[model samples]
Target: MIAIQALRAYNLFYFSLLSVFISFLPVYLSYRAVSPSDIGLLVGIGSFIGILSQPFWGMISDRRKTIKKVILLTLGLSLLVGFVLFQSSELWLLFLLVGGMYFFMLPTDPLTESLNYRVAEQYGIHFGSVRTFGAIGFASASLIIGFTVDQIGMDRLYWVFAVYGVLTYLMCLVIPDAPVSSKRLSAADLRRFLTYPATLRFFLLILLAAIPHRTNDSFLGVYVQSLGGSTGLIGLAWFVAATSEIAFFALLPRFLRTGREIKMIALASAIYVIRYALCAVVSDPMLVIAIQLMHGITFVTFYTASIQYLYRIIPEEWKATGQTVLAVIFFGISGIIGSFAGGWVFQEWGGAALYLMMAGIALLAFLYSILMWKREEREAETLAGEA
Candidate 1:
């Protein structure tokens, strides 16, 4: 029970920092006079670096058999690097500093998820129950920070972020360590895992589905500003989005038993089609904020289902690697594409046009999902017949 509480605390603080970073960092960059295209390039470069580093960090955690150590190291590095990042406004310096920060910070999700999933399994707790705290934290922090930033200045964002990072690090110190496998994964093992048909198909789908979502993440605040929304409204939009996930996460366990995780993901992808389309057309900033309610159906469902499905498919020894692989595909490679493309489109056409393009991507993902769902059903029926 104490362990569970610790997990929740860790999640709360971790995601509080993450919310600020993801939802407002671009705003902070803009306040510093960075152009939209440069902002995209900066974010894209960091994500590009993450494509290599996320897996490397996961491999080290797996090989060293110490997830906690890795977590602590990364958090500590983030704090140190972030301090310097906040002190500079120069584009070249920001790029270097932000890249350094992302290298350590980006992998925190998969690493923490790997730990949380294992801990939850061992203790007979639901992963969503533990993860829900993160949503709450994100929502709360986004609102508070947004209001604060509006009242004070974006310059204070760094200090607020640093405070949250400190809280997360302290929480990490108390959480129990997860068990490690005795056997280390090798090149051959990795190759075999990659070669699996389901694994390949899953990542491909993630890449396609992530295009619109990542684009939204990278530029939604900027888009809101363009639509005449203030910093507080941007924060409120993010808060609404994050808060919308709480009910979904709370009810996730009940749905997981239905064996319809893939269908849920497909449904979420379909929701993305509508959400982005609406976003493209909406004229009111408040309405844009209101539409974020769909995040519950889109991101929350997809994320929870993907984590559950990945857990079922991955071997216990390679748990961290599996999570990292998903992260790399969803956030790393897709992030690079989304950031650069979103930047270019935002500069060339506008937010509305960019979102319309995203709608097309979501449509492609939805079609692919239909085919994948049928394939899964066929495989299930074949297995049942043999039984």
Candidate 2:
């Protein structure tokens, strides 16, 4: 019971810290007079660093057989680097700081989720029940910080971020460590894991589906501002989107069974098609916020299903590394492409055109999902035949 409470508490503060970075970092850069394209490049560079660093940290956790230690180390580094990052106004210095911060910051996401999943399964707790606190934290933080930034100015973003960071660290100290894998993992073992046909296909699908989602994450606040919305409205926009996820996540474990994960992902991808299409043409910022209600449906459905399917296919011994691979592709590679291209499109053609391009990409993901669904069905049939 104590461990469960610890997990929930840690998630709440961790995601509140995350919301500050994810929801407002780009807006902060804009406020600092950095151009959109430059902001994209900086974010892309950070994503690239995440790609290089996430797997290294994951492998270290697997080798050491400890998630908690790795998380603590990274969180400490992130806090140190983030303090410097927010203090800098120079473009070149900010560039270096962003990379340093992201290198230690991004890996913690998958590591924490891996910890959350493992602890939940060990204790017979529904994962979503524990994970719901993260959504609540994100929604609440987005609303509060948006208003706070309006009052205190974006320069003070670091103080809000630091408070949540410290809270997360303190909570992490009380949570129990996850059950460790007993088998020793080798480089050859990791190579073999990546070579699985299913692994390749699954990662490709994640990359395709995640690109537009990540792009929106990188730019929606900026887009809202471009349409003449204030900082408070940006917070409200995220609040509406994130608050909707609370109900969906709470209900998910009941409806989201094992084999149904991929189909759920497909359904979410199909919805992304429509959501991005609407975002492409909407002129009113309030309408954009209204459309964000779909975020509850699309994001929770896509993220939960994808992670569940990943766990099903991965080997138990490589759980941390497998989750890291998922994070690299979803947040790292997808983030690179999304940040770079989104920045370019926003700089050159405008947000509407950028969103139109996203709609087209979502359409492709929907079609690709149909193919994956067929593949899953065929594989299931073959297994049943053998049985």
Q: State the C-alpha lDDT per candidate.
A: 0.89, 0.91
Tens-place lDDT per residue, model 2, 1-387, is 988998999999898888888898888899999998999999999999999999999999998999999999999899889877876789999999999978999999999999999999999988888889999999999999999999998888889888888998898888888888888777777787799888888888899988999999999999999999999999999988889889998988887998898788889999998998998899999999999988988888988898899888877889999999999999999999999999999999999998899988888888988898999899899999999
Q: How far is candidate 2 from the true structure (C-alpha RMSD, Å)?
A: 1.1
Per-model TM-score on C-alpha atoms: 0.98, 0.98
Question: How well is each residue in 1-67 modelled by candidate 1, as lDDT tens digits?
Answer: 8989998999999999888778987888988988888889999999999988899999999988889
**How many clashes in each candidate?**
0, 0
Shift of residue 60 alpha carbon in model 2, Å: 0.9
Worst 10 residues of 2 by lDDT: 184-193
Clash number for model 2? 0
